[model samples]
Target: MQSIVLLLWLALCAEQDVRERQIANTLTLGVGLCALIFLFVTGHTWIGSDAEEAGWALAFVILLTIPGYMLGQFGAGDVKLLAALALATDRQYLLGTIIGSGVALVLWLLSRRWLWSLLSQKVKNRLKAWGDESSKKQPFAPFLLAGFLLASVWIH
Candidate 1:
């Protein structure tokens, strides 16, 4: 059930990133609600080892990452997404999330041109319509998702 929720969250993030280039507030709220529901259903024991420490973990993650956001490295959506994920995970996994997302962004930046060339013209045009003027700055959702998965598996 936790895995299912994670997958759903990742899918929604990816979809929103591609089409809207932003994660709607409602989407983040929905993800948080789902996490809360899952916690409620499972007696809050299934999601993470230390549910009590999540708040601190969240603050820690935010403090470490918010600087990047404020510096215009990404956007508020990404920060909010990370916070939501922090709620769903423990400290180690949260660290994994940060590292994984960062690595994903770097890799995407390095391979963007080749990846863009691989996209079909129609897809490119659609992406461009979503305000992708330079075809750079690819969405971070997919990379974040990948990072989340990797962190979940390898970090703990």
Candidate 2:
């Protein structure tokens, strides 16, 4: 039930980010809250051992995300998405989520050449380049969402 809802919400958020390159605060907040509730209900905790477990899981997510965020590999939304999942799910789910994100990261890196071409085309046409946070271009949300959605199958 909670897993299904989280998966749906993750998919929706990923679509929204992929389409617009911006994740809505409402969606982020809603998803985070839902995950937290899921954790609590499962005895995972937002305030106790579960909370500590979540903290550890979140730390792992952060370890993966920080490099991406710093190296211009991913956006803040991606990191936040992982953090939200850490808050919402149990350690098992959280670890699975990390593995999923890692898979997404690999996919994104493998597709880097295409990303460069896309950026070059946009720049060559002098089109309004969106989400241009770094000098290098990035494929923002697709992979992160892919990871979350894929790993979510383990939840049930």
Best by lDDT: 1
Q: At residue 110, what lDDT does model 2 achieve? A: 80
lDDT of all predictions: 0.72, 0.67
lDDT (Cα, tens digit) per residue for candidate 1, span 1-156: 675577678878877888777888777767766665665665452365566656666787689878988887777787778777766766777787768878877877687778888989888877663345465455677777878787867853
RMSD in Å for candidate 1, one decimal?
Answer: 3.0
Per-prediction TM-score to the true structure, in the order listed: 0.78, 0.64
Global local distance difference test of model 1: 0.72
- As a whole number from 0 to 100, the lDDT of residue 85 in candidate 2 is 72
The digit string of per-residue lDDT tens for model 2 on 26-115 reads 787667776677676776643234667887777887887899889877777777877887787656776776678678768767875576
